[model samples]
Target: MVHVSIHSGLLCSNAAVVRSFGLAPKYEWFDTPEPSGKNEVLVDVLAAGLHPRVRSQADGSHYTRPRALPLIPGIDGVGRMANGQLVYFVAPDTSLGTFAEKAVVDLRRSVPLPETVDPVRIAAAMNPAMSSWVALRRRVDFQPGQKILVLGATGNAGQMAVQIAKLLRASQVIGAGRDSDRLKALLALGADEIVSLADEPERVAKRLGEAASEVDIVLDYLWGQPAERAMLAILTQRSDRSRKLSWVQIGSIAGPTAAVPSVALRAANFHVLGSGQGSVSTANYVAELPALVDAIAADKLQVNAVPFPLSEVETVWHALSDIKERVVFVPTQ
Candidate 1:
């Protein structure tokens, strides 16, 4: 058995985790676990993504809840193994999460990282970028010339959806966001048009309505008010009722549920579906990573990542309010 020192955030079963937020979990030392499974390898963790979902997992609000206490609090990370090969891997079990100096993951769950790619960038980009890439590539039968409308385009995931759509040769990409400045930035990131959702519902509807005639797919991240508005807009612009539009619901940052109108569903050419865990097969999602990481290495996927030390999780954790950049935690040497 190889013994290694690790600083991991321990989640207590009885603790009110959500109330603590950036202050909870509290890191402590632990002996690394021995690997014992098919393709299982012990890894020296380099960088772990401080994703918003980690907080949700700790608080017991995420879809994938913590099954036991004293759990580490990372969903995924980039690590260097005993063999000296660097890879990115996901934690199938929350009991042995990625926010540590060492972890054991099935080698099949990991994708080998190129030497040219920064591990921090890959750690930050994959979760957010994969939503749309896998959704468009697997969920929907997307063609090169198809047009895409990205709802909540100002957020990190939405921004990545825009980039992926363009990289996949989307003929037209419309970005909808509440922030005009960020929406303008999306234009340079390959978005052909921008729709501002800061206005009243009627005005937002009008904007979406104008573009509804051209949108072949809608990648919705904010699936509350903006989604309702988009639906209303599509209802008004149903030029060809026979032409179906694919709407892939990925995240619900706006709210858990929306007040979707019954008429809106019956009136338009809309085929709404979800794209996340349990929605897509795990093996297929893993298959897409090599090429996706290659894209990041080639600088095709655009993402801004800010590195912080694992020891400073309490200090810098509160600074994750900026959705434009990803906050990554590098294990302290």
Candidate 2:
């Protein structure tokens, strides 16, 4: 085995360190990371969001799992460099993550943040909002007047998708989910209609068909049975079968695989595509960050963030299910 040093030194920093998969990270001191390549800079990490993607990364369930153990577990965060410049950084799939007191950031994978901006809010909103933001901007030929339906619209990222679809100028936005309260809440977030998935399968299908039959695009976060049912419902109810419909799969909160009928593809001018890490190039993701950061800074998007000390990472990890707001870890706290 390759022996690694854990001794505290002048360059040591506190972080939530994961020694193995399928366990909570331990809060401890580790050597501070240094910039090892061109355009890389060390930043004092102020805030890192605990997103579902981060949870998956820690548990070794994410498709792009880290190669080795003894890793930090944040994918993106807001930090201040040695020169006092604040920035939002996206961590590569490596062991040195943003969950530490300090992190080495690639300048190309980060964007300068306005000094006046709230780091916690930026840290919370960027990763979740980027799911749909990058999808509409990068993956598809989304037009301004097109209509949209967000399939798991009550969740954090799903809620952001409703607002983002509106912000991007979609003519009508429909929010669909199992939570009635959250579905009702989406109306205020620019969802023209809401469908609850709590009813019988036929009823849920009928509701989706009525609300989103003619939608130009579907931002699907739930990709299993719900998605399969919604596809059939929308396809059957569509007045113009030949009208192009783009289905962008961004997450699989419901299940990993869908038993989509082959006839669904043959029925209309339908296109199903996935938008995530591998499908979107790093350059494309980075290029879209400036505008997204600006939107969050300008208060165009709603953000609810709750900060916790990084030292309590283990406790917080277990309590996440009870927390409704986005959880942000503050290293200094």
Candidate 3:
């Protein structure tokens, strides 16, 4: 059985959970009934992703408390609502796990999908798209001709940020990631330059400085010492031209926290900003999801999703937290 719900008890199905440490959670049967409330709808889960939040919550480090024991873990699902509409929904709570046959979800959190959109692709893209969209809107404010740098640029949200930057008229979009091949591959999506963050700390910092000197904005995902040092080195170097900076910090997949220099911020006149979902009001997000879908339909957006079968969820879940590509888990039976 598969899904997430706001209310308890929909016709029951077997769901999985992380029952103990170092071992995968096995499935157990549960009961569920049809949706009875005005704002709730039961959906047949078709696809979902093993997103970082899901993985962290499962691992007990997501900055939030773990769900109740015997938790059915899933936060995103593409499914059919009770009214028989094709939809995608984000369920951030673990009260109702998604690895079951079905669950009731709040109607407000669901987004109806286009007929042609693949369930797995939509499921994979939704969370990262929202994260990237919010990040771009709140963190990076680049003028049309401004140069922008995206660290961890190969990941799903990073690639989306690059596309969004170009869409919003960034003058130059430079993407730096772990893999040179992946960086090169992203150029088709409007990355003006691609560099590997593979060198030693000093070399990496110096290389980043030279690659995109006098950067106007940066969408950074890495949060460890290397990223922090590189950012400082790029901002602190002497130059006749003044470099006003804006940094939007979103994911810290690289490290828990960064060691930033307050002096560097002053020297560069940097405007460091945060781009997390915490700032986006739920109402506003609800209103914007339609527009976001339209933008995707119009080819004005792109997400680098790596599709895999639902059976490999644990494998994919672990990979999601790594500095890896965007993922889309399919019920590819």
Candidate 4:
């Protein structure tokens, strides 16, 4: 089979540290060639997202993958194949990333984009949206009618989490965030109520405490003292004396360390677990790809996205680093 390739890909490959997050870019545009294997499909990268965590990986702070010099750092993107089908895939490592004109990843990792969906729109949902989908599906052990609290609710992953909870038909979806402006928007995105984090945690806790009986799960993105207090208050005041709380930690945008009370947790059957989308096996990815794709195609899931052309990657990376919202980079356009 004959294949075409492009060389221009966004890079953390530079020797100079990018000013945005105090990290050095290492990966250089070594190559952008097509795959020769049967199970691997070369995707023409149209768009990619600049995840802040990718910067962490560059700085050698991200808990996963040790920092290796000269690695392309991107976690997600959308593109098309030689067959002309639109597909989006989140290439895990800082290697073989999607910040390029083209990328060749395994066939299983790619999900088909619907004909009606713009490539940029589909690409926008690749990174943060998957966090919501994968976390709720694999970690939360969520069931219909289970009430859940989503921290950082106005955020990309938070918003997506709210939508995923409703997709599962969660009982009471509470969205928590510092932005009341963004909170109000959650009403249409399946959040039954929005809790602003701007106020004191105690105040927010008291407000939620009244309805605590209905909350069964907590999807925590903010991990500071506020989150700790909120969790504690909710756990202690829940009306359903037997309401078991399950918390899934997906992010730490607020802060890393938290004073999690072991004694407080023991009060009820509360369970806490960390989720980082542990290396996905190829077979399992194949299975999950279809449903995830169908959800995006059907518009069952919504994502916040900003589209940019490939050449603007340098400026765009800065934009991504500064803004606390979702962004998608379109390459072929």
Candidate 5:
């Protein structure tokens, strides 16, 4: 097999503290490895997204440790193989990652891409957008025209959840977040109502309870104080406790743990479930990518993406640090 020369954003060999990726050299050039198995295909990378999970994985703070030292830093990307089939793929767990000019992915894990969609945009939005898309469609069996609530609606994933919930034809979409200004921005993004987590616990609970009275589904990105308040609110204020309500836990941005009143769960009709790695199977997850990408391409789903060349990861590292917008590395550029 002939090897191809390529560039990649490689993580340092040793574990180190990186305050800003600007100072940490993460990109390098190396020969691409050939696809080793029948199930694998080599891809000419187009774009790779820089996400909080990527950053954490690079820094060794994520739940899943780094694949290996001197490894590439992207978990997912959009690329095309020599056969000319454009696809969006999740990189296998290996040192060679999607940040490279070339990557190897299992064929089963790859989803065919539509020509109507811009590869870079979908590459940037897919990971964040997957949470709600999967949660509502698969985990919760969400119904169209139902009322939904987004607990952490200001962040990238939360914001996408708001749009996805509306795109799914939810009759009402309520957004709640810590920042008042950011929460207000969600109203234009499809949130029918907005609640602030900045208020006192009692006040936040009251507001959330009022909203929960009509909500059929709750997409929770924050699992700490806000979730505690919202859960309590549901327990105390749900007009009809018998009404079906599904609370899908997608992220733990606020904190890893939440103190919940055991009585709340035992008494309320609300169902609490989680969505992500283990909850949703790989085949089901891959199956939904096409529709999610289609939604993005059609402009039904909106997101903020900042693109940078693979060689300029250091220069745009600070920008990537901002969770409000997604920063993508375009290797072809």
Candidate 6:
């Protein structure tokens, strides 16, 4: 493998190093990674979000998990280059990730951010917001005036999906989630209507059909039973079954696989697509970053984020399930 020269004086730095899967990472000193490719540059990591993707990666459960051990567990973060330029970067799937004070980032995969932007907020909001932002912007022919239903809208990413759909000029945005309070709160974030998914199967289906029968797009974050139920409800209630319905699966918070029936595909003009790492081209993801960054930088979308020092990673990791706000690790004091 190609390696770049680094000053002998700056060999190591403290990081959240994971030596094995299914365990909380340890904060310890580790060798700083060097830029190994032509377009890569060494960056001083500022903040890395503790997203579900990172958790899965750390536990070796993510589909794109790294092959080796002693890995850092951050998929993306905000960092500063030697020239003092601030940027939001996606870390490559490697042992060296963004949970450390230093990381090697491919310049092509990063977006330069305004120096005035809050690093913690940027780190917290980007990954979650990108789920729906890229899904609607890149995954399908989403148009203004189209109606949308965001499954699992109470969660972080799903909450942003509600506002993003409105930002994209959807005529109607329906938010559905298990929490009644959170579903009601989505109204202020631009959801025209809300559906509670906490009800029994029959009632949940009835509510979904009533609120989102004519929606043109569905941004599904909860895939297993919720997705299957929503699909059947919308299909059965639609006045025009031939009307196009684009279901973009961004996450599977409920479960990985959905038991979709053959009739759901054959009965109507239903199109199910996914929008994540493999589905969207890296170039496409990078291309959409500027606009997304602008929105976050300008405070167009509400971001709920909490910051914790990198040294406290182990404590934070175990307590993450109880935290609703996005937890961002600050590598520097």
Segments in model 3 whose C-alpha atoms lie over 4 Å from true places: 1-10, 33-37, 139-143, 238-243, 306-326, 331-333
Q: Compared with the true structure, what per-residue lDDT tens digits does model 2 show for residues 293-333?
A: 99999999999789999999999999988998999999873
Per-residue lDDT of model 3, residues 160-187, tens digit only: 7788778878889999888777788879
Model 6, position 251, has a per-residue lDDT of 90
Better of 4 and 5 by lDDT: 5
> Which RMSD values do the candidates have, in order?
4.0, 2.8, 4.0, 4.4, 4.2, 3.1
Give the winner by TM-score: 2 or 3.
2
TM-scores for all candidates: the values are 0.91, 0.97, 0.85, 0.85, 0.88, 0.96
Give the Cα error of residue 227 in candidate 4, in Å.
Answer: 2.2
Residue range 1-333, candidate 5, lDDT tens digits:
123333344322211123333345355555565688999987778888987778766666666655356556778999988888888998886656777777888988888887666888988899999999999989987889999999889888899999999999999999999888889999899999998888788988898887767788989999987787788786677777777778888888988888877877677777888898778988899889889878887888887887877877766765555545788888752
| Prediction 1 global C-alpha lDDT | 0.79
Give the poorly placed runs of model 5, Cα more than 4 Å off.
1-25, 319-323
In candidate 5, which residue pairs clash? none
For model 2, give the 10-residue run with minimal summed lDDT: 1-10
Residue range with the least summed lDDT across 10 consecutive positions in model 4: 10-19
- Tens-place lDDT digits, model 1, residues 136-248: 98899999999999999988888999999999999999999898888899988999999898998898889898976668899999998778767867756777866878989
Best by lDDT: 2
Global lDDT of model 6: 0.91
TM match of model 1 to true structure: 0.91
Query: Cα deviation of 289 in candidate 4 (Å)?
Result: 2.5
lDDT for 6 in candidate 4 is 43
lDDT of 1 at 6: 35
Clashes of 2: 0
Residue pairs in collision within model 2: none
Q: Which residue pairs in candidate 1 collide?
A: none
> By summed lDDT, which 10 consecutive residues of candidate 1 come out lowest?
10-19
